[model samples]
Target chain A: MANVTAVTREPSSEQELPHPYLLFLGDTVHPGFAKTAFGLKQWAPELCLGQFALPSAQIDLGLPNLRPAEARAKGARALVIGVANSGGFIAASWIPALVEALQDGLDIISGMHARLGDIAELRYTAERHGRQLIDIRTPPPRIPIATGLKRSGKRLLTVGTDCALGKKYAALSIARAFAERGVDADFRATGQTGIMIAGSGIPMDAVVSDFAAGAAELLSPDAAPDHWDVVEGQGSILHPAYAGVSLALLHGSQPDVFVVCHDPGRTHLLGDEQFALPPVEEIIDLTVRLGSRTNPAIRCGGIALNTSKLEAQEAEALCAAESRRLGLPVADPIRGGPAFDALIENCLAAPASS
Target chain B: MANVTAVTREPSSEQELPHPYLLFLGDTVHPGFAKTAFGLKQWAPELCLGQFALPSAQIDLGLPNLRPAEARAKGARALVIGVANSGGFIAASWIPALVEALQDGLDIISGMHARLGDIAELRYTAERHGRQLIDIRTPPPRIPIATGLKRSGKRLLTVGTDCALGKKYAALSIARAFAERGVDADFRATGQTGIMIAGSGIPMDAVVSDFAAGAAELLSPDAAPDHWDVVEGQGSILHPAYAGVSLALLHGSQPDVFVVCHDPGRTHLLGDEQFALPPVEEIIDLTVRLGSRTNPAIRCGGIALNTSKLEAQEAEALCAAESRRLGLPVADPIRGGPAFDALIENCLAAPASS
Candidate 1:
């Protein structure tokens, strides 16, 4: 974290980067692994200049294919590692391409478990070329354990049924919707892509376990009485692997209201399909019961379903049915309309218990 | 964990250290901060040769007082850091004394959040002296995310109502009782002190939040059909700050049965007294419901009450009353008499629901 490591400093909050990026997809064949690129292209399309990937890569951003030099020529200031490679390591085969990008006059950025500064080739190349090697996942130094104190202002966190569903999208959409309604709100990111979009957040999963809750507390600090910090959530509490991160975020944020984000199409938990996803009703019940330790007035806002697979008519019918059954608003953020608007209104309704 | 840091490598399981120790109490006044020392003295007294503390320190182990050279002459090989400093950082005031220990030809062992090898003076001194600077809280590398696959054999985890109120002691005692009963059982350490005693464990708090449960899985892998891993627990499920760590351990261990460890006299949580402790009934209910995600047959073993503050007669009466009322064995581990034996026996009584 200091003199021994190549990178000398950790970002205090969200890390900033050069605009107009060339997204590096590496050799990712699975679309899930290339979420970073997809997220950035979706949320900050204007900043993403082009896309680059190995020939073996199967997924695409549909942006122009450009080498680092070509992107640099088109005013791209950085080459962002857009794909989350399996095992969180920079693949040995991908080194030459990363080195080439550095040599082509662009800064390099990554959000992997392994630090970019630890890679000798990339570290040396960046130092020689005077370009930055930024790691977005690094949490700030001296994050104290959470006090469990209820902070000022309103908070709406996006809880989920599983990982990589629609938590971040739901949070971003809710924050945007609040803004459009002339409500003071901010999108509080908690992952790599969201951090890139919002320019700040604590990577909840990357933090040491003991300080995970504390980091969440820091991510959305106490605000004004009427302001809302729309907190982007991480893994689901029902998830076997990452639930700890999810629980920590829950306890630390102590959100007054929460929305369940789910991929209605997914029958089972992501990664390990042996277990099925808990229903939205179960998520709301548990989030309230557990979150009450910090904020006794905790309530559920509604359900945010990622009905991306269904046809428009089918999706609307499904939402309507689910809404009727659960007695709560349900909508896909991307398919924003009356349903989505109702969700925004539902979020602000005080005494809104699930 | 590799070339970038002073320690060239990480252990795959619990870190091992030289035996026959001098416990370093630092300049601590609160006994709570020196739990490592207290736990070791209680569980592995034979390995503790003497106690070492600064003049300002008020807590004592009641063992022979010795300097590094004196303890070394008395057959101590490692100077164990007994105190967990308030901020988890080694104070500058304690440095000169630590240096004196390193100069006296013994390894310096610690379980602090900050790495001993990261401290320039200590790192250089250890390097010059060719002595190990052991950090017991270092977790295994390449800890995979938990799959939540239930493993072979029976497991009993010591869950708690709060931190440091006898979870480790209860696990150790239960495992010992199992051994005495001619049952095949292994004590799985989850914290620093337990690691030092058992010679292998994953420091649950030190793991990345994403892999906290994964690390717990590695700590007690698949075992024999008749074997029982008495997995030591960490934070409480009701804890605002550390419940994530607790939940991860719970899901990863996936204990068929669990015992609730609590301090009977405490009205509120340890560090933060703003919140009151949730009833043991609440812990059992939530644990069973949430734990059913990975382990549908999860059951409560009993209650382990740390009744150290009460008189002997009062403690026995209180435990007996609680046992009768709750229909679950309740006993103080330290006072291992009839009640303690019943608690241990009840742990094996299958279908032991709360």
Candidate 2:
């Protein structure tokens, strides 16, 4: 019943997010859940100032840990909430720190399902300090149901075997690689973290079920015939809870080619342990089968293996082994090298026979 | 914010929906899109007093047509929307008639995605007349992510080859038949019309993608040792747009057994004609394959065929032939007879071995 004066940023609100940002990890220990922070630090490091964590936090971003005032003094523009728990809820314990950020002359930006403006103390603090509360997770006002009609231009989507396995990173890398190769391309973000880094995206998780795929379509509309939309995917098609989001993204994006992103270390899904992560082969098959309903030309590009847990040489050996077994280029997008270039080359070149 | 006071009926609001209703068909010509009206007419004829339609309405429920005033005068308490368009949006052209209904002392109960109270004129009219503007397509306040834990007791979900293909009707029929046979059972609604009929349900489509499955889990929780929760399903797992919703519901309900609902006439998906409906065999296979993640013991029960377009003898012949082909009982629930009873019997008996 409170005044529905919640913020509605302008069309270019992605540009409204000022930088350098102070990443807020809260007290989350799991790296998978803190993907937003890790992604920003990885993709937009120049725009980031430092990190902040609650005392009970066990994870760190390797950046300097500073308080709100210190970060504000260091010319940080906003405190970006980076961790996403099961529900994307804003914890009550973090409110004091959030309010401090506002009082310390920094705006608060969040991709959380629970709106920051909806919290009374934060809203009051923001209003008093003239600080902004930007929620990039908000979808557009009107999104039609999926037309199931293919649009012009090519698209390459990054899918995964589980929830947070570097789909966004692969997308960002492929888009950048394409740009470097003098091919016109764009990184289309489907989730919150990708949206933050790319400056705009449809928060697939926040969308209603009916309009989920439609939102994806609108995000990457018909572009020039040669242009490519390197779309970042969401939840896995095999995940117990978020598979719907992933499938909706797949159908909507209708990628001409897709890359399988996987964390080889994860046996079970990120949060739900009942379900095991399907093999990269299963993900490719399902993505193609379901995605073909929208685009018949859909095919796999390669695999972006997240070899974070492996030694450099060991990761290379695994990538080599996977490439040999699957007959597709496999490489870690983060460890960009000749292998990643080969993977990108296979994706953008003439479509593979398979 | 317009006071944010449009309406909020208590938890007992389902009981507050005054019956002996006037079904409102607003300018809709397609019979397939008007499944809600047809469903109520077929399943709950006694509570349906009469029909009301706009000048442009081409579809009819075969009940005596009456204006809101006439129906109200004849003791109809509410005007229930019985049509679902592409997006469940209320047409602006029908606003005048809706206002007239409110003026005539009839509450307006709609399962529309666009809320009646959100329309200024409708809200003002309802407030002025002290008539409740009930929106049934509302998810509960809190829904957790699907735990993927198989609950106790049993569940029989009615999935379909496509949407609006007698899934809700099939579920309602199964539940009622179970009760008739002295089996402990309950009808769990998933969509608006089903909820309106069942008195309570979670509108799966309205929920956020993250909590979509979780909402389904909450809807049909653990029941008595031998009780059956016959959940009304939504959208097809093969549907281009709504497959995510269907898959989420499938995983969430984790049905011990499921019936494949289909309209023999519909070749393609509703609204989106690009997709061809998968065969009943495919539906059963996919339902069991994907649904096995949550409930490994899941299996196909039977099939509920909608044979409204065929001759009585032709319908029976098709059901018989298809039953032989698929090795499962098949019958039109609306065409209740020995065949229908046999279909229910097969479903409730030992879960049929595939």
Candidate 3:
């Protein structure tokens, strides 16, 4: 396993921040909740207290849906909004429960686009209870405009076919794989959940549009030449709703090598039904071409398949077919297999001269 | 001339703003002052009052430089800092003159990256005088994250080789040219001077990095099908100092066609002596390919040459040679020529099947 350092924010001397024991608030029906819970459980098991679901909701992720009072009683210090819904607005129905948590002196933390601080009631309750309302989606302070200058060290980016198709997971997995091989690799998060886990990185989407790429550039400034920055990617170029963010990330990362993350079962681009997903080959070509504009040696290092929806046998066959088709190492990094090892080997090897 | 509409901010009813007779604060030695003055004269003639220069400096842009006292006495309501120096900061030497203008009750306006409001002395003086200090480079209120949705109507973007290489001039000239042909074309400014003249536009570089493209997208939302948006480009893909801005503009504009802006004499990319400007053909290819990732039909419509450094005869020869070589219309749009007409025709013509 990689020697992952959890970079937490410095607490004020007067009031040391409490270590968060999160009570994830989302139903199993919400894919966002599942994904968020899964990510936290896999990457940050220590912080996750348990899930908090409605009576009618099923607890499928194996985490118990503790009662709000029980959660707080069991050391749940923060109510983490795990649902990644469209527009990022918190559901009105969830407000009453969240208010109760705030009143009970539990801090509120969410990665949603909607800020709990923006809601007067939540802000008032949090203030009254001396509970912190942390909005993870807010952009970090004083992000400088990107100069697009080359920095020291090797960089690898995980670009995906669409949003939330496992770019972060692929990056993390790769970093883990690299670590297992005794390679010096670091994970650089660019989005909310990743930032929450990494404890740093610009919430790129929350940032003003002009500086998105600049923020990405800031993440991996000067580094040791032998070190590898496994930078997590954001939205997809084919994603009509978030392509600008994707482009900014692509340009900002300036990676020497990139792994294309793909969800083969995704028929249409998320948040955009009218457009169909372009062939993986087309996306790979586009990513490499656009990325190479800044770093001429940039190329597709491998392919990280999100085979969560596929059977093990089917996923293996698909990976084999893709490996043959693209002439690149292909595998689901999350699935324990030789694929992750092969991917690490491929990236560490010298890239062919373009 | 195109039916240019000045989109000025409404003054508060409690404080009726005075008509700004600007005292352009820069000597003839500073190209920024001359260019800002020239752009104002060409586009927003009604807004121009006069210039401001040091006693030892000459005013060569044909505008009379009034002394701080004379400028205010002669109806100058604002002191516009027009010297676009490296890093866009006002020099310490200019502070005394600026302070004098503020003391004389002139509001301060600047397009520099440095904020006059951030300077303690300037802020104190402006507050004491109840004068507004406007930084045109400050980002607009409530710029949404870009959806990358296909908006109605056609867009034509002017891309360039480097910063200050005439992307704005080329865009304006094309819009004017289109208007002469009875075409319904609009100029969408993405920089401060363009915003100043147009009376509306986002100072894209100042926007938080994420929303730069979103701001550009908002500029021409739901326009007529035949209406052409001549979007002003910022920086260059080859320019190390500002390529992030350029990429944001390129992706944000989402143009169906683009005119490549080139300053032929710029051997090295601006601000970075380590890198040289790639060939115009390579840039054109890169732009089209990168741009096509969003709108597949996006192509280079023509070439707008910034032949300001060349003599009339030399410019004409270069334009002709480029037109023949690239097989695209090429000319200095500022100089009276058929190049603009040729460009419009080329764009309106159905693109070849890629």
Candidate 4:
């Protein structure tokens, strides 16, 4: 899918945040974070998914089955999001959240209905770099990547492997790391399909999707203030039907600082046992090749490793080594935490041209 | 996606070699070979799209776009057939030719329109196989699979798979191979939905399918005949969907030979610097496990490997190694030709129950 809008969302401390922020919430918040992170690892490696234990003080912030605008207006910092006709619980609450999130700078993200019962009452949570959630009562609207890049703000993008993996988790982890380090960033899920680029300061908002038939309403150009378009792909790129949607997104709307969340584990080599994660050098080469192939002048930022299985030290070391190998700052800040935050911070740091 | 009746005509001794036959007789010729092969392959690699090569033939068999019965009557020794609401070529042909082909023994297979262009027909043009082309025309009728299997020379049930690397190709390939090797086999497609099995050898006159919606026309308690069924892995056996489908099929239809075609590429784990292929031992274990998981006493036969890039030799070696490791002769004779022929042969070769 294509990036929707290409406006600048520089991390100006004075810029107005979304009033009554629209957080596309789902059931099983942290687990959703975990799953999102796992999925994002396949796209961005240096980014991390941080799992901050919810503080005992937070209440169950659920706009159960509320419209996006309704949820936003009713003092919901997070709106549990779902698909339009998905015959599921989260679908009822989250579908509208997405619309409102886009319309009013709502800090909305997609959520699932399956695990709603687990942590129904969400409370205060913590990120690795000490950006603890005192209360989600006033979650700030994340600065769009375009704006950050205009002011040379670090920008990052976190992409999930497929449907389920902790994309939000990884984005949060990456975002919080940079935030604590005094970098401005935002974390968001572009949509529910594939290769969702968040924290790319660029306000280019569009989703070029192959499965647009399933999520067409969300991709309307008029849905959000950002530019939105749908596109297709050639062959199986990352996963089956992934390349088409990503190609559409990249070509349809050019977002500055594309931080791809990647998991080497998901990459299959024509079913050959001899083909696993190509060497780090090969990965860099492949990344450049992929970027070039996608667009000759396309500039790619650092890789974000999904440290789903790795501990903090191991993941950090792995990211650092990869960064050195690729001559890029591989910041996998959160080991065993949500990688989404780390992803946001990474996007904030990306050089605009590259 | 259901199999159409096929016209089985032996080449006359006086006929010249390299006989021109309809590679695909539109939607009427049995798609037996195409369906099973394609279905098996589809079930193999988790890759969504299926690729098939059209059968090799000097000229079209004049069976494109023919309706179900009309296409079956085409005077080809071995015809690839399928089902289409609007049949194409046979609007003017005599019914007698079709009946004669079916009665005298027509080598038929089933398939669908989507992959019709892919199944490469390898016609045995040489008379050395004691083949002949006859001009004896007859009326169109639903011919039985073979003589001895039926006490009254009729069939009760038939099974097939979905489009592209599924059970249709597997079933037809086996059927063709068996017939070539002196075993009587009748093939049928199960429409766009379920498996279609034709019971011809043992007893009964009509074909039977497990399809509950409209199977009463053929299914009868007294109907007795040689039976075969095709089942594709719906979901990963580990996946809940697969478990459910497997259980339902096994319990409902106690199939004779459970032919499974799968790709060994997708199941392997991904690691750094090198790729991994799931061990053949694991496949054996999984197949046996799946069989036991589905039903207690169901005899799980051999596993067929569907290779995309691997050459025939490599594929055979892989299958042989797996078979040896599993302590069973994994039938690898299909060798990249087609799926139906291999499947049909597999069914015919399955040892009779004690």
Candidate 5:
């Protein structure tokens, strides 16, 4: 049996240094490598100690590459698995290095689908050493089943044509814009990275299938009148790999209004290439219709286009074309434009009690 | 701790009688009481020992009411809680009587939302006496999460405007009609009475919210080219109390064609009286549209009218009027009619691979 500790540390003051963390990047580095590493650096730089990559790794994001011994010498208290892979499985070759780090008394944190606790040897070693093994992908506790009641005020959910196509970023941008406009809006996260940033919100995909919607419902609870709950969307309903999660979230949020997030440059749905992305208009219509099943007043308020791959001029031209064709506001939320303005206006104009 | 036994009883021969069951009916009796009692009698006669109801109870369909001691004397090996109540909670007043029956060495079977195993005193007594406590509403073992893959052959799902409005009866009727035509068809149940009739089918509502769809998918696996999987529907997507279960089933079944079941005599949604039923046309449109999200080819092939409360002539007139109004086949499945014939024809004409 493991000796479990229930320690409650006082919040550290700004003058005190942050707890140091080491990042473990196994083999098979890709764009995800930079995203995870740079994302941590940008969002939680106070906790980052350094990053460690295999000698054969391809990409680097300007973080110091250190050995386990060097990371320990530098006072790293935890090792965060920094590489993202398809299916979120930790490679077998990385197990030895991870075991070594756990044995050295550093707590481990991961956002992988294959949980660390399920790794028998690694879990046993971590337990024996009295070190923490945190799996960020696990669902939050005490999520109740959805009652499908009309929550107070209104909610705007950002749904995507596919995963990793900027749903969270769009939601955050919209919430920030609303905040700037002196509107009472809150951003609700539903994934690991967003949870890391928000410090609260459920890891939706990690939840058991039955209670996924319940988790989403809890995250976007009744807000004060005239307030907006901007909920982050997970997988796409058209996504063959994760439609169940997507449908659960869609039904769970029961948004008063929704924004369709799309990556126009991509020719195929992520992970499944057999089907192409449906037209933005079709997606918006489908989402609104599905959301309306729970809340009859649900509507697709706007569209958030992911045009990061295109040149600024090209992206602007595409957004304008999409706006004209779909008869809805369309723009990259990060780039900021009339789309966000129209989106906010449309959401604010919706019946508050809907 | 309970002394659990794993017994495999042989099928009873004609000369030998099956294990007898006594149904426990608490004070109040309603249509639900008769449905449960008569449903068990009609479906599984081998388990029908008799029903026990209070002397003051009113609605009796000619079933014998026996005391616990009398039932025990009649060779009842199990006592089934036969009365259906809102939220399925057992009445507190009935607990003592049920405990007495359990302590008398009779196994307990129930289809209530309140599981007997959760009752502290009754559970302790049952455990001490080595009596089995079975909650039929509990989900069956080994249900998987839905993957949204297209199974082989064709599927026809019965969607209702509300619960207890005969979604299962409609599906069963269509399946029976198809069978008479020499077509390979199977009825897949998703609720308690249907499960009891089929001898093996998942209780969709009892399942954890996440795996509800998975349970449906498992019940209706891939079929041959000419085969039809007639999947029984549960709660209505429009029903306030059970829409989550409805949505899960719709997405999970991925039916090629659907039949909309509605109680024309009912003026309001079941459980929630505030919302009036939408027009039959609207219901068909909504069901077809929601189902099409998972399977684009999904269409509302026909309509199943629940005209049980109406006179024969009135029911026929209503079905005819509805058939003309909705531009689809409509008839009470229980009443011999053209609705089932039209449904079978429409289903047979659907593209085989969809």
Candidate 6:
């Protein structure tokens, strides 16, 4: 609300503001404007700042030791943090309790404000955008769910065996698909990556930061109803200690649909069967474990034939067949190019029969 | 101490044992067992029937949530929770805090315990092993550290321009170097991946759950002093979140040195000539911002050549020269084959100075 300026860096007004609110949901850290600005400006000028949304976050280093009262004095807001690769996040264990407490109507804070309960009206906002659950809330010391409650757009989740399996690409493609479907989906990384808004149709040129400043404005209620979409990327598997931390951020605000991205070549392990990644079955199992079973989680569709591994016709046939088997529609989002765009539109147009 | 009996299918003998004591020390996740077993094994592993140590951990489903009373009721033993990727890990943050509180000053959950005014006793130990760290402490529900103590262990921040440029690989290699120097350096996903340790090491076959069990024993002080060195395989940097988190686990344990892994290929693109990774640099900046500047950090080494990218001879020469320049006792930790074994051994060796 305070002009949405960088807490540390000097704000650049003339240079289209980094779509601090455009969540770039993916596993791999997408390049930030500073990095993407290197070349390809002519064709993808939007990738520079105004036309794209980067996943990079700018962390507020000064807030680590601030008490809730002090943080409040400093205008600190409540947050809903998500870790993409839970098994691999540095502060992984702290997430669940933080999310749980917030879900149970407790105001979670750091060492300084551990006891400053109730002063901050914080909640983890979960919105169903497109077909996935998008966790667009900021990290603690600033949960932005209440303000942006009205703008809950699309929700997307990308799952892979690990970061190497190309979940990030799938997330971006899904975000693109949602945009083409006339839905506003913001890419959100739940783990270590910075924001990335490549391909097309984004808020700014891939704004990247260590914090969730990208979707900061949209996270509040005062923001316009731009019909947003969120692409939430996860770093790695969520382990037990603080098991449901990430999902808790989505507790009060669950997504509409949950799409699991699988690089068929990798997930199916070339159909070796035994090598299925993230063990598709296990992911579905874990969602229930984290208590998200109540939400309608359909396979929706998947990305199996990566251009790097399959032929065009083969890719088409693979997606089409998978959709047929699942009694749903699927597309390449990226490889199918514009035609793929049509497929996504059709899927979104279909009834929410599930 | 209790016997660490091996069981079939589910092993809970040690986990269920009363007065369970698990001793953890340093960041053993990298060049250690956790990284090796991760992604390969299910989150559940009956850590010693009653008390056991995990090489590394992240918030997960299998992690048992023990309240303060539950932890204290277990009694007379300690569990050394080592720093995983950075800042060291908290089994379940509050769980450890609760454990520390319940122990009534006779336990060491993590560096937090140290801050909480608990006595710093035997460094490490494991069940069945006659190590003193496991024998002399009471149980948990304690706040290892006081309400406001800064955590222990090294915190690694990554600095790099983009992925594929070798930042993640560089980070892993550096973590290994620090471990060799006896500095418990923990890693957290920072910027776009640069160099990673994804596809290297003993391969996935060596990652059976049984092996992890053995590893936990070996890392315990009760085991042979040289146990960790004899173990095979090392951690990988497959995902950014996991990589960073694991790195942080290592860092929090406070190793003797901080090594920055860089890729000569993108030395210039990395912004900081010193570390060669933007995230690494950002980490350094963040650390400084967090107000800890006395720690010694270094740009120890990196991967020199990829066959398609550079001549083999040049890559080898550059790697050798860099190792030589640093007076490093080992060669390229990332590229060398079995020779990497020596790298692992060297990484585990305590630093002479520290």
Candidate lDDT (C-alpha), each:
0.86, 0.84, 0.73, 0.33, 0.72, 0.32
lDDT of 4 by residue, B16-133 (tens): 1121222332223444424433332332222111221233312222224333234335433433232232432232232333333334434333323222212222122212222232
In the order shown, the chain A TM-scores of the predictions are: 0.88, 0.83, 0.83, 0.42, 0.79, 0.45
Per-prediction TM-score to the true structure, in the order listed:
0.89, 0.83, 0.81, 0.29, 0.76, 0.32
Could you tell me which 10 consecutive residues in candidate 4 chain B have the lowest summed lDDT?
B201-210
Give the per-residue lDDT of model 3 (tens digit) for A167-195: 99899888888888888888888887786
Return the top candidate by TM-score: 1
Tens digit of lDDT per residue, candidate 5, span A235-347? 77655445556767877788888889999988877655656776777777777766776678887777898998999899989988888998877888888877668767776
Model 3 regions more than 4 Å off: A1-20, A24-31, A49-109, A116-133, A238-241, A352-354, B1-23, B26-34, B51-110, B114-135, B138-152, B238-244, B338-354
Can you tell me which runs of candidate 5 are displaced by over 4 Å? A1-111, A114-147, A205-214, A237-248, A292-299, A335-354, B1-37, B44-149, B206-215, B239-244, B293-297, B337-354
**Which residue segments of model 2 deviate by more than 4 Å?**
A1-38, A49-108, A120-132, B1-38, B46-108, B119-132, B352-354
Q: Model 2 over residues A1-354: C-alpha lDDT tens digits?
A: 232234443224354456789999898878988988998998878878899999988898999999999999999988999888888799999999999998998888888878998899998988888888888777766788888788999999898898777788889988989999999988887777877787677778888998888888887888899999999988788777887888888888889999999998999888767678888997888788778878888999999999999999999999999999999999999998989989988898886454
What order do you get sorting by DockQ, best first? 1, 2, 3, 5, 4, 6
Residue range B180-205, candidate 6, lDDT tens digits: 65654433222111001121111111
How well does candidate 2 reproduce the true complex, by DockQ?
Answer: 0.67
Q: Give the per-residue lDDT of model 3 (tens digit) for B1-354.
A: 111111123211222224455646554465554566667767766666777776655555556666667777877777766566667787777778778887886777777878887787777777776777777776656767666678788899988876778889888888887888888888887787786666556677766666666677777666898888888888776554455567667776888999888888988777666567777787788787667655778988888888888999999999999899998998888886666678778877777884
| Cα lDDT for residue A57, candidate 5 | 76
Query: Where is the poorest 10-residue window by lDDT in model 6 chain A?
Result: A125-134
What lDDT score goes with residue B103 in model 5? 80
Best by lDDT: 1
For the second chain, the TM-scores of the candidates in order are: 0.87, 0.82, 0.82, 0.41, 0.79, 0.29
Query: Per-prediction fnat values?
Result: 0.94, 0.79, 0.28, 0.00, 0.09, 0.00
The CA lDDT at B16 in model 1 is 52
Local lDDT at A51 for model 3: 78
- Report the backbone clash tally of model 3: 14
Which should have the higher TM-score, number 3 or number 5?
A: 3
